[model samples]
Target: MSARTLGRARGPLKGSVSVPGDKSVGHRALLLGTLAEGTLSVRGLSAGQDVASTRRCLEAMGARFEDAPGHLRVLGVGLRGLKAPKAPLDCANSGTTMRLLMGVLSGQDFPATLAGDESLSRRPMERVAAPLRLMGSSIATTDGKPPVRVAGGTPLKGIRYALPVASAQVKSAVLLAGLYAQGETAVEDPFGTRDHTERMLAFLGHPGPLRSDKALTVPGDPSSAAFFAAAAALVPGSRLTLTRVLLNEGRLGFFTALKEMGARVSWERGGVHARETVGDVVVEHGPLKPLRLAASRVPGLVDEVPLLAVLCAFAEGESRLEGLAELRHKESDRLEGTAASLRALGAEARVEGEALVVVGPARWRGGRVETRGDHRIAMAFAVAALGGAGPVELSDAACAAVSYPSFFSDLEAAGA
Candidate 1:
């Protein structure tokens, strides 16, 4: 059963919360590692059901896995070592799992079919499939939706492609397909996006040489750290440190936006892992001011928009977020769900074309929030509920389990 928010959090949210491991990396570690030689051991892995779908898909392709709570041991099948599944691969609610898996399957010799839940079935797969098709892989979709069929052994060859918009998943799909392609595959993002897949790929020893300085290269995911950052800020007197967060130029845009808006966020003990910036973040209560956003920084914080909206609700002044046109195609129209959730909490929000404007520190009262079955929306509202807004009841709270199965328990551990 779904849990209910009784009232605003009144006590000092105490203790340390080791939030789930990076969902993006956890998926990559399982999938890519399964494709490599030798055994792969993943620690602090996300137990989220969505990532689990990736693990299961890999296992179906001849990759054996022994999962122990937070630790997962996966046996690698070497390059091009996957076996065709006996049945269509069900991706559940994960677009990432399905899209990226297509890239992996594109370079193989056997056929595999990809399908998913209603939400995943509705997402556009054409973006990745078109690129894969260009690489000589024969892939078909039902009217640009899921239940995708792939006929492998297409002698894949890579080509440089420009992104119509900045999307990590699309870029990652192309890059992963490039792994087994005959030549170099380069993705040119005029507007850069997240590089978690790239960084983690490099960390695991298989990333292609990336050209930087023009784009905000993938930075470590502060998206995963956002919850604790908010927790530390809201918990009053709590000082929680987020260790080893990637600080790629593209990824740090969130921190930059938040800092500009007056959130008490900072980086500590910066280091490098396989050339990517790694650092810690410390957050405390501060008078958060409103921040302005536009095209240049939108792609960097795309995944964090929902949590950013929650922060906007608690900030002083009007927070403006623009260039969200792409948010429309995510698991749900995030722009609409975000604004609608704010309105449910008695806050003021509006959408102008692709931009969203939120007026903050408004009374967040009780109301029902329709999640649209998106994981981020489900989790974002959970953070909102801690504001003591009158009984914020969420419909489809189960959605959070997709990316963060223990989200509520972690929030509780942090004294929410």
Candidate 2:
């Protein structure tokens, strides 16, 4: 594992930075492009390892990609055009690739096995497998985990599924399977999750209400912008503007929580990108106030909880983050990882039931943070180091390349 030491901010993080394209969007774009009948042009695609994993897997299945300076032109072979791969499809550390691809492969006429790295292999694949099975896809798994084997040539039928949890991946998986089913398939989540897949499908002229008012152009990732927002909020006099970020309502819970915590966060409507909302976010350092986060909002900002925990460590008084049981199934046991990271940074944090309670305004004496090969955990702690009492050393710091390859360098450029 690679390690890096992060020092306290030399000055307020001040600058306008362009984060990479949305990872969720990038993944869906590539997958949908493969099923598209014509050449699909994708602008500002994420250049992360996770998206690369999706691209590699698709190429193995016969999709061709034409590269451009900052975009890609994918010549799709249409739905049902994917050929069976001779070898198992390795999704690497990307659960999105494995889960969503399961849906696509279910409708194929040839068998395919989806495998992943150790961390991803440990994540529950049965959530996706069980649903595809309902659609008549024969899938076998290693105790509900990775190495998911899908037996192709099985006919599929559409069924309405109410998600037990709000999972964009599972929902998208089912919907993708629906495309090849005999009838319409619908997924209903009690709490809405990121709808990138739905939006992209509609944009590509797939039949459904998932269509948008404008053409599809993927916006910058809000999750990536959260790290910079946290840095700006923690460092005095820090002001940062993030450009062309996805401002989808279902994905703004973290920013909402931050605003409630007294962070000076604001946004202006930029325009639409890829049928998704795009905007400019301005985050400035300010006095943070402690607040309670409802459990219901967890699904919307699930990916940002670790970053929020870092902010909570710096805020005055106790901050309770509820309804985070889903964190247990992520790249790591993020609930435990977040608490452990905070404790290592000299803050009071612990998991109580399904929630994480952090007693804060504690001195942030930075120390070693174990990332457990989770990219978000690595990046969150890196943000925490910006205002720490000492240098924070992150083990497996290179794991940030999974999502944001330029994270550390961009952080340094932001003066943190």
Candidate 3:
């Protein structure tokens, strides 16, 4: 594994960063485009390895892709147009690609096996498999892990299912599979998820709200923007502008948490593009207080836990992240990994039940970061390195490419 050493910022991170396209939305766009009847051209798709994995898996199933200037034209094969892959589909490190594909493959008249890299292979797959099996797809995982095998072409009857956990990906999987099932397929998630898939379906002429425009322009990823936002929050005199970022209510948990922590954050809501709200956000460093982050807030900012954890370390009181059980199943045991990262950086952090507790303002004695091949972990610690007591060496920082390929470069540019 490769390593990189990041020092405390030369100065307060200043200037603007145009977020890469929202990967969660980017992933869905590619999947829905493949299922649509005609071509769907997407502009500003996230150039991340995870999204690339989705494209590769779809291509293996015979969906065609064409690259033009700033657009990816996906020639839709419709619902029944996907072909059987000659070999196992490799999803790399993207659980979104693997789990979502399980739903997409459920109705096909072919058997497909989805595999992933070592890290993804260890993450839970049965959460996606069990519900899929309930819908009549012959789906099985390797002892609740990856290498998910799906025998398609089963007669599916939809059932009203409740999500046991607040998982957008799982909800999306079941809903996607529901598209292939008979009868009315309904899912009730007590805690709602980002409605990208549902909106995409509607935009593509299904029965929903997102048909506001013909060409849907995906906005910048908030997840990627969180790193800089955290860095700016930690460093004094730091001010930054994040341009054209996704302002989805379901995805801005971090921003909400930031305001509660006393960060000077504001945004001008731009026009709605394809049912997604876009806006430019300005964040400035300010005094931060610890907030009791509850479980209900987890679904909105699940991906931003690492950055949040770092922020909590600099807060005056105890910051509790409730309902983080799902973090254990991510690319790494993220809850544990996050606590470990904080401890290395000289914070009092630990995991208690489903929540993570951090008592701060930490003594910022920096240390080495063990990424465990998790892209989020890698990126999170990189952000934590700024304004720390010493230099931080991150193992396998390249893992950030799984989501943000230019993470370090962008951080440098904005922090310069």
Candidate 4:
């Protein structure tokens, strides 16, 4: 673990920046490409540790990857061509890797075991495993968590399932396993989540047509764009342009929240890539009113809750973010972490049942905040530091490398 003190910006942040490729899209592309019938080429893949974990796991299963600067050419092994790994697949800290790969491994002809680092090991696998088990796959877990074991070669029967919770990972895992099932596999989420896997599958020529309401392209990660947008919106005189950002409706909850709060934000449509809509967004400093987010909207912006909490800290009046129980299971207890970070920076925030309430127009008195080994928490607080009263000391700042390898550098480049 490492620590750093981030100082407040001396002037308004002004610049244009291109964030790294979307982590969610990058992971799905590599995983789906590994199992596709022909060669697949991916541009602007994320160079982050979590996505790298997925690549390495796929390689362990005999998928060939030819890497270039900013691009990847994957020769997929066909749907049934993967060989069992000689050892247990180590998923490191990526829950997405572990959960999603369990689906891929379920239909193989050989048994497979998946394990991960401490943080990932604590995440519940049963949300994914229970459904896989329903598909006739022989799978087991240690008390519903990691160290998951799957006995492959079992024929799967696709069945319709309604998600108990709205989760892109669980939905994607079921859909991936559906590729090997005997019939169409369907998952319905009343509260929609990100659809990167579905979009990438369609792009790669999946035979079925998705629901009309679910059509998509896996654009740039709007969650990543939230950090920069916050810095520009909260820091006086700050004006920044984020290029080629994903405008997926399911992933735009944070931006919508900002707009509802009266932030000075606008966008122009750009071209599409990989079946994902892309656009350039301009954000500038402005007065933000309080926002009340409903529980139904939580799934769309679940990843951005920490950043939204930070933005709320600087906005006038109280902002209540509801439907955040899922945050308890992320890389960290993000709800607790978000509130702690805000309190450490002299803001008033607390959890009320499933909602996080922040009383703001905060008078920031910068102090040390713990990252708890969460990338989003670290990045959110770092953005908060840009408009703070003094230097904000962050413990375990390096954890941001998990999702955004160049986050600190990008922050500097944007003059934050």
Candidate 1, residue 208: lDDT: 37
lDDT, candidate 1, 293-378, per-residue tens: 88678888888898788888888789889899888888899999999988988999999898889998878777888888887887
The lDDT per prediction is: 0.76, 0.89, 0.88, 0.86
What would the per-residue lDDT of candidate 4 be over residues 1-416, giving only the tens digit for each residue? 99988988768889888888888988988888778776676777777899999999999989898876655787877887798899999999999999899999988989999999999888889999999999999999999998999999899999899999889999999999999999989999777888888888888788752212122233556778889998898898898999889876677788888888878888887877767778998898888888899999898889999988888888889999998999999999999889988898889999999899999889888999899999999999898888773588889999999988889998998887
Q: Taking the candidates one at a time, how many backbone clashes does each contain?
A: 5, 3, 0, 3
Scored by Cα lDDT, where does model 3 land? 0.88
Descending-lDDT candidate ranking: 2, 3, 4, 1
Leading candidate by lDDT: 2
**Candidate 1 TM-score over all chains jointly:** 0.90
Looking at candidate 1, the ten consecutive residues that score lowest on lDDT are: 210-219
Q: What lDDT does candidate 3 reach at residue 153? A: 77
Error of 2 at 128 (Å): 0.8
TM-score of each model, paired residue for residue: 0.90, 0.97, 0.97, 0.96
Range of the 10 consecutive residues with the lowest summed lDDT in candidate 2 = 208-217
lDDT of 2: 0.89
Q: Which model is ahead, 2 or 4, in terms of TM-score?
A: 2
Model 1 off-target regions past 4 Å? 1-3, 68-70, 204-221, 235-238, 244-246, 273-277
| Per-residue error (Å), model 3, residue 343 | 0.7
